[model samples]
Target: MKVVNENLPEEKPRHLLGIGEPEDIVEGVRLGCDTFDCVAPTRIGRTGTIYIHRNGKLEKTSLRKPEYQRDFSRLDEGCDCAVCEKYTKAYVCHLVRSGEILGGHLCSIHNLYTIVNFTNKLRDEILHS
Candidate 1:
């Protein structure tokens, strides 16, 4: 990707497909890619997994985990997404454990918001630098 990025003209935007992981997004940006699209975010969301930013790092979190069963905190602190605004970790965990479809919906909402916000931040940082 680095080599291809170097060879491409600056006017040509690089768009990476099926590369949606946090690390991959950052790396792709570093390699001069301008855009990305992938199903990994929604794919994981379907399984009750979501993404969160912590200590300046991005990580995956599963609502079905034991710890979340009693965790009454928001899915992601400081997130304004609808799911995070109204749902508790315990509630989401319970929903998933109980085999409810809402569990995945909430996770998807939070995960997609995280990913979009992450990429936007990355772009701002790159532009300012």
Candidate 2:
């Protein structure tokens, strides 16, 4: 990404293909990428994996894990997404363990929101800098 950013004209928008991980997205923006596309968020969400921010770092949590079976906390702490606002880890874990479609949908919503929100913040920071 650094090489690409160095070679490209600064004024031209750079679209990064298949880059969707939270940390990667941050680095991509820092390197001047203007946009990104990938199915990772929804794909992993389908399997009950979610992106979460903790202690200033991005982490992946699998709702299907046994530890979440009794965890009643929000999906991701500090997230304002509807799923995070309305659901608990235990509930989502039950849905995923039961193979309910709503589990995937809720996870996808939270995952997408996480990435989009993070990207927007990065954009704001760059704009203000």
Top of the candidates by TM-score: 1
> Distance (Å) between predicted and true CA of 79, model 2?
0.3
TM-score of each: 0.95, 0.92
lDDT, candidate 1, 33-88, per-residue tens: 89999998888998899887788788888888999999999988868899999999
What Cα-based lDDT does every candidate model obtain? 0.89, 0.92
How many residue pairs clash (N, CA or C atoms closer than 3 angstroms) in each of the candidate models, in the order given?
Answer: 0, 0
Q: Which 10 successive residues of model 2 have the least lDDT summed?
A: 23-32
Error (Å) of candidate 1 at residue 62 is 1.0
Pairs clashing within candidate 1 = none
Model 2, 1-129: lDDT tens digits are 889789988789999999999888888887878999999889999999999888987689899999999999999996999999999999999999999999999999999998889888888998899
lDDT of 2 at 124: 91
> Where in model 2 is the C-alpha error above 4 Å?
none
